[model samples]
Target: MQPVRPAERRHETVARLLREEILRGTYRPGERLPIERELSRHFDVSRSVIRQALLILDQQGLVRVRSGVGGGPFVAQDTMPAALAAFENTLAVDPSSVAEFAWAKCILEPAINAVAAETISDEQIAALETNVEASRAALERGESAVDHLIDFHSILVNSTRNRFLAIIVELMSRSMDRLTGTAGIRHLDGAHVLEEHEAIMDALRRRDADEVRALSRDHLTGIWREELGTD
Candidate 1:
């Protein structure tokens, strides 16, 4: 294994210390974290390392950074952090693997919809309706609205409230999106995608688990394979 850089080691150590303190209720939410100089001295690391640690904590949704006087990192209200580091690492694979990621999506997304059918809330469905409307507008403007399309699926997956499931789905979708963009599949059939999303939304609203699963899978296949007929 490659040797870890000094800064990397310091940041990890400091982040772990801070993370434990926050989780153990040593630093309650809304309470300001110790200043950087104090943290650096206490941890025997440089201010840069302390800053890096705080940045990691912020990204993990464990702390909020404040600016100006009486401002520093504070424990955030929502402390749960998904394994998104894994998702980003997964998204970094070779471009030739787009077909593989797309295949995985066919299996995964439909399952997410099935779960959403059982666990999704009215508020979540309403958010999906807004996503549908955004997709419609994008198609009307002759755009793929893949971002909106991605958001729609993301919402569906997150509605399951299963972080691991959401992370897996996000990893696949993000990978496929990156690969398709690199392969010039960005201008995919926006109108067709919109229709499929709307249909999926309808099924979800009716809480038809089977239809949601089938339609979600079909949508991925229709767009990923049938639309351009290319990998």
Candidate 2:
């Protein structure tokens, strides 16, 4: 028999190889990988080692394991949440990174908004209008509309119809959420948020890309400046 490697090293090696394969599209997302027995034979390791390696991949959100009649490892359907969680954890360790993120959003979102203005459908505009109206009503009822307001940005990203942009913006939004809880260093007044969103929505409705760009720039600048206490 070949000399046995330590279990830890064996599992880590297996996990690394599987992770690379999944990322390289050898195993597509949501596709099932081979059974533990098959994987063990393929890697020349014990089933326990395969399980341990799978556990590592699961922790990293590369693959998911299921149990029962239809049980085995499968590549993750959506990896963005895992990536965002990792980014949020990193920002948590250095709260100062929040300011850097704010600057990035300030620079990126306005361009995205301009692009969205050029291509956004009428249905999308209606959605933004509805969100803005919801915030307005919530504020009038003396309720906090913070969560609704945060979701406005998400809706805007969706209107862009760019999958990659959606992932990047989602990552930034998650990081911001971590840095600023429900009521943290930069709590946006509901009334102000409504007004800003309304203006941007109007520009989008007109399909006026330039106006949307300017309004979005102003809105993000206000938020980032307040959040970072910068000019």
Candidate 3:
């Protein structure tokens, strides 16, 4: 392969450095970064280069620059919405890819239940119960329970406390929203669904990893087959 050009290499270096520091929690949420002069000096680059780097970070919603006294680039506190927006934008450009994303989720989410069974806590279990209750209420009121459904799955993934799994679940939730939106699948009552979720939750409560894994797989498979007609 040919060597990278100087400008391209510089951009890659800056982006990688910033991304590493962000992931490492060196620059925490709501914490302002040093001024452009300081960053340029530290990186041995010009202010323009630092500005370009910051711009890229800003686009990724990792940082935001404010203009005024005592203003600089601060780490963004709410990255989820930004991440969701980015995913939606990509789906808009390639609508057919949404189905493939949904298929991937059908495989991945049930597998995460095994992880949750091993790692979940009582507090997480309580939180999931709360989500289930909220979902039931939404259904009773004839309101769209899509948000609650997303919340329920989010809680399940978060209960695992695996960042990688959480990221995958987040993407899957967005893809599900897009899929249902296009297919006109409205929110259904949680009366039946809650039992399925409760089975997984109960397995977690009992610390039965195998049962949790099996129940989760069966639940997701049943739902996908019913909704998407996919086996």
Candidate 4:
């Protein structure tokens, strides 16, 4: 891999630190961040680098940029949804990234299922069963099952009770869905997805961690295979 330049590295580091701090609630909504010069001095970088970092944060929807005598960067009021929207608006999430996102689902969902298999409550399993039933009905009615498919996976993620993992999965799933929808990739095989979801639910109900892991991986692989045209 190519090396990162000093200025760019500093800018990215500062931006990541600031973004994490804001996300961790160090800076609340409507609160203005440190001024450009102060931040530059704080990070021992040039003002331009600080400006670049702030611009990155602005693009991520963690902050909003303002101008004039009383304007600067302020923390976003609703960071999560705003960040997702900003990500969608940016040209960054293209076809390639969508494919990669699907692969990430292949990686994460298995572990999520592993955890959910061990810790999920009965109510959670029943809820997933409900989702599976809904998906089956949708498929029977000749409707797209992707929505409930996403919802079923979402419920599985949340069943792990890990906020960080759930949030990451949610963001990636949301972005992938938006990209696929935009690109008109709506020819998902509803019967297959429904069957896999039902099988996954059965695995979860049986508390079979190994089967759940394998099933989740296979399910997500099916999704990305369709996207990557490797099926």
Candidate 5:
């Protein structure tokens, strides 16, 4: 194998360090990262090297560049959705992928619900209730409840206040719509969804973590079987 050049190694090192700092919250969202010249001096690398490193970060949605005076790289917080969309599009995914995604959701969301059972706030519960109600209303009007269903899941995941999990759920929802389209599974009527959601909500309200986890898993599993005809 060809030897890795010193310049390439330096670039890799810089990228790793910067990414770690961002994940560790040292360089938080909206904070201006050190300027190219400053980072170049600090890392003892060339400005070109710094620019290349920053370019990589920008591509990953870790930072954004602005023009004019005082413009510099600022750590960006909008990475998750964009990253998810990019992944889904790149895969050229289809409906069966949605069933697989639903299986994954069963694993992740239950744990998320367990966490929310312990930590979720009353206000968050209220907001989720509101979403469920709205979903029901849409169903009653004989409208598409797909968006509402996605919104309901989005709200539940966001209630965990875990950015990482939220991103996964966001990506899953996108894939889910594709799966539903391919399977020809129309949205569940509002009443049916409301009853299911109410059960989940009741478990959450009671802080019954086990029930919450079980309900979440069963719910996703049922949806997978019903909509995707998956076992």
Candidate 6:
């Protein structure tokens, strides 16, 4: 494989560091980040590279860009929904990226769930239970449980108390939204999906790491096979 160019690597590194800081609460919502010139000086890169990094953060909705007087990248106040939407919009332009995202979820989510089983707090578990009940009610009412189901996975990720995992899984869940959307990729049979969610929650309550991992793997791979016809 060809090596990543130095400029590409620099911007990606900058973006990752910035994302970590943002998620760590180093930057408050609406707080302006360091200017491009300042960041370029700190990183010893061109201002253009800093611009590229800012663009990435903007696309991820971690930062919003404004121009002209007093305009720069600032921490987003409500980032989760915007991040998911922005990430999904990016994936929509590249059909192959959807498959790539699926594979990523398969690999990452199970590990994330395993961590959550060990680290999850009582409050997080309660949130998850609430999500499950909401999903069940929606299904019973003949409404789509897709949103709740997506939220269920997101809660599991957040339960890990790992901000990076939360960010990655948030983006993946939105791609899943597209996969289960009206495009007919495959409609998630709510009843069956709810059963799996309930099972996973039970394992989480028991703090069964191995069981959570196994259940999460099965749950995700089941969707992969059903939707993408892949193992």
Highest lDDT against the true fold, candidate: 2
> lDDT scores for all predictions?
0.76, 0.83, 0.75, 0.78, 0.74, 0.82
What is residue 25's positional error in candidate 5, in angstroms?
5.0
In the range 1-231, model 4's lDDT, one tens digit per residue, is 122256668778888889878878888999999888878777778888888888888777788888998998899886688757865666264545655567766897698789999989999988998888888888788777767777787799899989888887777767766776621135667777778888888888899999999998887787678766765
Best by TM-score: 2
| Candidate 2 lDDT by residue in tens digits, 1-231 | 122356648888888888888878899989999998888888899999889989999989889998888988999998777898898888888888878878888888889989899889989888888898898888899998887788888899888999888888778877776677632223777798788889898888889999988998888888778766889
Best-first order by TM-score: 2, 3, 5, 4, 6, 1
TM-score per model over all chains: 0.60, 0.83, 0.72, 0.67, 0.71, 0.64
lDDT string, candidate 3, 148-216, tens digits = 765677788888888988987876676567656622124344566677777777888898989987887
Candidate 3 residue-wise lDDT at 133: 83
Compared with the true structure, the alpha-carbon lDDT of candidate 2 equals 0.83
- lDDT, model 2, position 156: 91
How would you encode candidate 5's per-residue C-alpha lDDT over 1-231 as one tens digit per residue?
Answer: 122246667766787778888999999999999898888877788888778888888878888888799999899967765576665664464534555666776788788878888878899899888888887788788786666666667777888878877777767666565545632235444466567778998998898999989988887777667766667
Residue 43 miss distance in model 5 (angstroms): 3.8
In model 2, residue pairs whose N, Cα or C atoms come closer than 3 Å (at least 3 residues apart or on different chains), thus clashing, are none
Once fitted onto the true fold, the runs of candidate 3 whose alpha carbons sit more than 4 angstroms away are 1-26, 40-46, 126-149, 182-186, 225-231
- lDDT string, candidate 6, 79-138, tens digits: 777767766777778877777778788888899999999999999999999999999999
Model 6 worst lDDT window (10 residues): 177-186
Q: List the residue pairs that clash in candidate 3.
A: none
Better of 2 and 3 by lDDT: 2
Q: What is model 2's C-alpha RMSD?
A: 3.8
